[model samples]
Target: MIDDAIRVLAGDCTVIAEDADRSEYRGRVTTIVKPDNTVLVHDIDGYQPVAWLTRADSVSSDRTGDFTLVAKKDTQTLRIAAHDQDGFAHYPTSAAGTPVGDCPDCGGALVRSSGVTCVSCGDRYGVPADATIRDDQCDCDCGLPKMRVERGLAFNVCLDRACESLDAAVKQAFDREWGCPEPDCDGDLRILRRGGLIAGCEHYPDCEVGFAVPAGVVDGECACGLPTFETGSGIRCLDATCDRALEGALETEPTADD
Candidate 1:
């Protein structure tokens, strides 16, 4: 209880007279870090950091950058600490930018990938040309979520709420980079990484031409023990592995926006 009194600073005190904690530890507020919720108190003791101080704002302190007072060994001492609103300075969580939250169009689940593009669509999230804007009134009262994805990912925001958009995006990139190179319909082929060089024509059933694959995000395994690539042509076959990949291939249905 006494310690709480010191930390909370119950009374209005004047100057930080003596030392209850670090005797020779007195310094000015140097730099502050919000990521780790720490502060550097600069003084003759060099720049020592005080970490994990909560509610440092509730009370006054000799140190700046927001602080509280503490008493040690019956003497008043200043301690750099955390305040209620300091979360933004030392927070670890990342927020989705406009248009990057739940899709305003459908309220479908959206994620802010840390990389250069949306993990689902592989589209560059930050570029305006790479995406389109809509006056979304569906949910988020504010408007479209902001785009934060960097440009290094070499993709554009599908902004598509359905898994179909994701699948299409992946296929578009893959085909652009590694065309089937087959004659007649080489460009429209689907690359399947089953166990070896697995690929087949997107125009399936009528023109069946399957290959082997070595490794990739598998769609599913056929009854014949062969893995297949899942497409948006509707559910025709239920390859076990393909089912899993298909789940990822589509966007999760979103709920209310905002």
Candidate 2:
């Protein structure tokens, strides 16, 4: 996750914005320095910012006495000098989204921003791309939110990997359960995570047989001796391109795009 802290300086500040033309703004304004170094100077006049610089390549601040913040991007620059600094602070922030639960480490609001994140403490939990954050909290001592993930079956597991690992659950349920579909390879399909969940050959480097676990539940066995997953697209073989499943299984009409 990127930095979730935002620097704020509010007071009677003189703002200088340089772009296609030079302009200066002076008032009791609020200067917001975003996590990505974007600077926004907002006055009491309107909802729109008086002056701003987009995500800058460089940002420098001097708070010796009167606070000074300068952000530069390409050829544009936004400078703020607070002559009478009223308040200056760095606040932990997160995107406003559906609240999952409260953070166990810090009593902060946990939200779905990129992943499950603590709005106050900045603690983050990686969730499966297809998983849904459930309202039902985990029973474990960690007190993290449970996520509904579908690998073979719908699994309700804790978001924190240390408390309840999704990989370990899947591995316990399905590891070495399938035989390798590769010709003459006496290897068992093993559950593993390499960026994403995958069922790879136990003989990894030698066999090089790996298939990404689709976001679906296992419905039946494929003619190719692999699992047939009931996915959003319909029924599909674990090996996406298995011709045997296509030949024997019921075919669904291609979904029309809206």
Candidate 3:
């Protein structure tokens, strides 16, 4: 979640910025304090900000008499002192994208950015990269949108991963379903979250065989003993780099003469 944007609008402010160098200006400007604590002072000047402090370590403001804002990073500092203030307020903002649904917590409009995010409340739900967000809503109390995520199969999961975890669904569907491809290894492949989603060997320390879950639904078993996935490109083995499996799959395909 992110904090709301704070703005000082239509004000005669003096800006002093210092890092490796020092610069100062005094004019009617607008100051924007972004959610990430980055301060931007805008004047009649072109596209770029007149003075800015990017993701400052500390940001302090005093609107008692004159609206004074000071933001500092490691070695950089940006200061703004307003002589005549017009308005100061906080506004909610979110990344722009296609609308998904409403936030159950704040009743804000949820849109798909990198993930599903509420514009007003700043609530975020992480989704799988290959998952397709559906128009239908979830059946859970969270009231979040649903997504079609493909592991071994396409599953309709809640937008909020915590409410209905994609990993749990995948694990339930495919865990221990495939045998380890390693020779002389009687271990089964277990679906796990080792940094990322992967089908790893049961005997981990002894047998280091593991493959990243492909961004597709399982089609069939591969000649390499791994599962073949029907990806966007084509059918591919769980181990994407396995040329032998791909070659075997191609070789088994029936020709026009057959």
Candidate 4:
């Protein structure tokens, strides 16, 4: 979703900027107002702003066809004038572009609108805009492509429901260092619901192990080479038998240097 703090304007305008030291810069520029009301003036040739005013500064403007805007701080002031133009037009900023691929459900065009959605069947896929689809296939044997969501934060997920990797991907996204907790089981665990704290084993009917995940717990590894989680209670090993042993080792271990 587009943030409410950003305002976009396009048109021909001239800007005159003055600093506290009485230095001045004048140019024809485009303006963008941030959510915090910070004004950014941009030249036609570059992406960076040529002049700016913070939200703390006061601004005044005239609405006439030939308009004037003045922003004032302690001693600095910026004056902008609109001239020799058609008019100003506002356009919504989109981080996502045209359709990435067809919808899996009904073969409809899938485009990013808030979230990735299908234009034909109205199916909503919960993939974030920042996520990227990989060129590889999922291990689930479903021919569909796997999406690498939250590149640095999680693993790839298969969009196909017929594949088992779909469940594995959801769990890996939420749990740091997430994996199957069951002994000798290679399956992974995933959150049972979106925005919920409960996580369950993906190898259901085979490995019945599941647990209630504490809020804000980060999955990690213990000194004893076992999976661990940092909980409010403390850093405890996933295996109950190794918890006490890992706790003693952690207490005596030296912390890593920053």
Among the numbered candidates, top TM-score falls to 3
lDDT of 3 by residue, 1-258 (tens): 556665555599889999899999999999888778888888886989888888999999888987898999999999888899877888766788888788888888888878888888788888777878888888977778899987778899998788888899999999999898889899999999998899999999899999988888887667776878888998988987877756676468656995
Candidate 1 residue lDDT tens string, 143-229: 333322111123333333332233344445454333333355544457553442235656666556555422233344333333343
- Model 4 has an lDDT value of 0.59
> What do the candidate models score in CA lDDT, each in turn?
0.35, 0.86, 0.85, 0.59
**Tens-digit lDDT string for candidate 4 (1-258):** 233434444455777677645544555567776545678778767677877888836766666776567777777787778765434544433334357676555676667656665566655555545456665756654444566643223556765444645445545566534577555988766567545334557777687765554432345556555456664456666554553466655556556971
TM-score of each: 0.23, 0.75, 0.83, 0.39
Alpha-carbon runs more than 4 Å astray in model 3: 1-5, 104-107, 120-123, 140-142, 220-223, 233-235, 243-245, 253-258
Better of 3 and 4 by TM-score: 3
**Candidate 1 wrong stretches, greater than 4 Å:** 1-26, 36-164, 169-258
RMSD of 2: 6.2
* lDDT per residue (tens digit) for residues 213-246 in model 2: 8889998777777888988888889998777845
Winner on lDDT between 1 and 2 is 2
Greater-TM-score candidate between 1 and 2:
2
Any runs in candidate 2 off by more than 4 Å, and if so which?
Answer: 1-4, 11-29, 43-51, 64-66, 73-76, 81-87, 105-107, 222-225, 241-247, 251-258
